[model samples]
Target: MISPSTSQVIPRAADSASTIKFRDLDRFFLGLLVLWASRAWFYPGDVETQIGVEAPFLFYFTLACQLLGFYGLFRLGPPRIGSALMSQPLLLALIGWGAVSMAWSSAPYNTFGMVRATLLMMMGCVYFRERLSLSDIVQTFAVVTGLVMVGSLIAAVFFNFGRGTGFHVGSWRGLFSHKNGLGEVSAFATLFFASYILAARRAQLWAALFLSVSTVCLIFSGSANALVTVGSGLALMGLAFVTSKLTPSKITNGLIFIVLAAIAIATTFTLVTVVANSLGRDMTFTGRTRIWEIYLRFAAQQPWTGWGWTTASTNEVMTNLVRTTLKLPYLRSPHSAYVGLAVELGYTGAALYVAWLGKTTVSALLGVARRNDKISILRASIAVGMAVFGFFEVSAGVLPCLWLAFLICTEPKKQVGPGKNARA
Candidate 1:
């Protein structure tokens, strides 16, 4: 089993017990509130949006949390949480570009707001460093996921009950106003909780319940993409387990199993969702492929910087061509994150973006494979989930979810067998 780096020591405070707990509770509450009231959290028609307010209250609240976190960073001074997050060469450069990207973002103010939120979540992570167990983190996710499921269920019941829409299959939107948004949240939550469930040592039955409920929500979402991603991720993990069991020697076999599992899961979901439309799904994905082609064609117009941020908004010509040529509806932007980055940031930005992703992916996979510590399996699962979702959701690069991914990747690995990180 791997031990902590000679230089990587976790910081502790004289009276950190209650203080750290408070921070975790605050963070969890903020996240829950946002997820529960996401629609009204910062709506386009809300006061913040109507009065032409540049940044939303949620944005400022997050910024305040970051300020507090920075204070904690310096005040609670000691060995940093993990150098990989702040000192990674490629990732650091990418974050620098991301800061610049915010200036030219389609919604600059919104992007800035989200950045603050992301930082705040990271603060919560650093503050509660060794205070949390694998089970502790998992239960927190389960709680948040439970909230998400309840919200979705409420919205679904509302849409289907006493309405004249004739029981539409795809009209149920939970915290957000769109069914697709609900699908994204459910997919994220499912994978998030599922990783914890798999790594958990005790309470397997409760973990099973969480997975079952999350699965039902994902299916009822009727989001073909979400279903495909979640199903494929599980299948990939299952394969990894099977292969690990088959190996003659389990020592190096476990490491190989972790690496293959991460890659397989990542590749499966990315390919399935990215290609599902081309295989005829009769949905937004059906239009994504066409959108990608059109984005490339326009990007070729100016390969260097391409079109500046919001300046690259899809025009009617490309939208019409795709809809007519491919018989799909008009989608405003490339449905894929990579394509979106290419259209807005140009090749230079796209190259940097991809490099950043590659670096992070490598770091995550390495973090899983090299460490025989606790939560390695969970970290691997999270790395796979991030890669899978990156293909479809633009938020893969943003807060809440991104912060969750960071926790999974950077947390200390428990030196137990695979899928049993948390001892009973």
Candidate 2:
């Protein structure tokens, strides 16, 4: 027999009330919005081609996400007061340059569509910056990734939703539309979880669990590129770790330099030859080299302005080659983000994009160096993961949902420690 006060009714009630706070709801809905609108295997059509039956619905659904996201902002309060955004102008410059390229886009109509989507997504990123804290962003992202893992397991058991065919054979696709897409996201999530674990080193059971699931998905995805991206990210982190530990002693410095040089050479050589041989692939990278060759040759003709937002400078050779040789019904990029950007927007455009990524990465690393917060360290790892992923994939330019997550999470925060009031 417990008395009313002794049972702690008031505290329990307070805790219950806290669970349903506006901010909590805000985080859940915003995370769900990112998932709904981002690149997942949930039956949405590509920005260029409306493939599935639900393509039209998904397109409009994403637009609604924009409106809802704005309303959510209004519900909270006015936008934050600061020039924090102005401090980071490279992202804006990148998107703005993308808009300007429409004038020279080979596919003008498609260019407008793609740019319009990018603008909407850019707004989402801004909303992320204005509203959520860094903790809110990473926790929400981790939660969503956890849901994806559970959903993939269920889908795989009941139907063929997550299984790969053709070259992938018995591999898993998880909830992604393609094996590479699944692998890419899974690998990125691995970096995310790893960063979380490394930063806090406490209550990391959830992050470790997510990391294992993501690694499994990455392996089952059979996306060689995804595997390579994960490896590259690890190598980059290793390099950062070693560099962080270096000393100023002359003998130690000389030894470290020699070791680093040897490692770099071995990594480069093995990445080119040993990796390909082990994977049963050739130097041409399963015809990707040919596809890139064609696109590069065409891009050279219009090096300054190239083509458009979602296409190479000229699709004539690219289209014909895919149709005749590859037998793929639709035209695709050269399977590398850098090459795709160079072909679509020329070297100048690609440089801006790469520069924006580099700036974000450096900012995060600087924050980590300052020990600003665990989230800052997490963002640094994520940026490294994205840099590696960018070499083999394209998301920032094509997919809105996942790219929105990356842009939002990786938005630089100066010094907002692990407290509740931290900045995102």
Candidate 3:
């Protein structure tokens, strides 16, 4: 790990955030390349059979670049790097879980791989934390979404299923193989761009355009979960704006946050059944519900140290749902990270994981509430957006969440005035 430079004084941290630099950008792009290549490379046929370059050589090349990039970043400031990594209790919890998994993981290699990816992504967030403003991140996401939408449009135009009747708009999957993944990505892009618009940056027209394209993409991808996540985020953003007038004392705000969170969780569970029925959506939840049910029962059986990671992908319970139930092919992941962890790691691990996230949520809410500064408030708002996203998506396991969270958590702790922070 590289140390922080001694020349600059770290600002008052609702929390301290690291700046992202050119090297950091390189590392991030390399990481993305490695991930995209892994889909084609890495883990070809069965161990006994030879698969053609199953593992992509590009992964190694990108990995090497990431290492160099990270090293350059670490050299900039040891103190900041170390402090950012160690100070957050939530982060500590994740590390602790990783340590435990290394010792007891059924699929040690897979667990190790996940740990490495998680840590690397987090480090990237720290590196970019200081350099990129929130607006910068938002704008970048908009640009990326625009490119994705363009690609999707081309695919739709070229890959026609019939004359005059092109592919189903709701089922159009762009670069990502899965429609839901596309929906989720577009939804996040929508939220990201909307965040900038709400922050009242000059890119209102661009942001609106991004949101329009992303909305079309979101509807095209047809992911119910994506809809929920994006809708909830927007709702929260609206609530924040509406409630801006009702400013309370810090202690009072914190208490209200706690109360509201508890209420939200409970209400979600109680109303989940009703909402499911009312939507009359697929009972399988596109196969996720079956997985959820299986995991729920399986967790009760062991409740502690799950069946462990399975490379074979044979375990019916691992996949949770059978073909008859969901009509989908055999899947390795349980769809939901939280469900997978609960079934594989048991309640103890799940609790620890939740505790970590809980801490992060609280810290973010506190940062937003306690800080009188405008920049701090924007940071807080982003934190809240992330928290809202977590409710619908089990992001603890996804690379994107790690990157987004790290970015939000590590932003510069500068002071600001209220007018600058207010939503447009």
Which candidate number would show the highest TM-score if scored against the true structure? 2
Candidate 1 lDDT at 377 equals 50
lDDT on C-alpha atoms for all candidate structures: 0.52, 0.63, 0.51
Count of steric clashes across candidates, in order: 6, 5, 19
Clashing residue pairs found in predicted model 2: 38-401, 38-402, 39-402, 105-307, 134-424
TM-score of each: 0.68, 0.78, 0.70
Choose 2 or 3, whichever is better by TM-score. Answer: 2
Candidate that scores best on lDDT: 2
Prediction 2 global C-alpha lDDT: 0.63
Model 2: worst 10 consecutive residues (lDDT sum):
1-10
The deviation in Å at residue 83 for candidate 3 is 2.2
Q: What is the C-alpha RMSD of each candidate to the true structure, in Å?
A: 7.0, 7.0, 7.6
* Predicted candidate 1 versus true structure: per-residue lDDT over 159-214, tens digit per residue: 54311122333445555444555666667667656766554434667557666766
Off by over 4 Å in 2: 1-21, 42-51, 68-85, 242-266, 269-285, 313-318, 325-331, 366-373, 396-404, 414-424
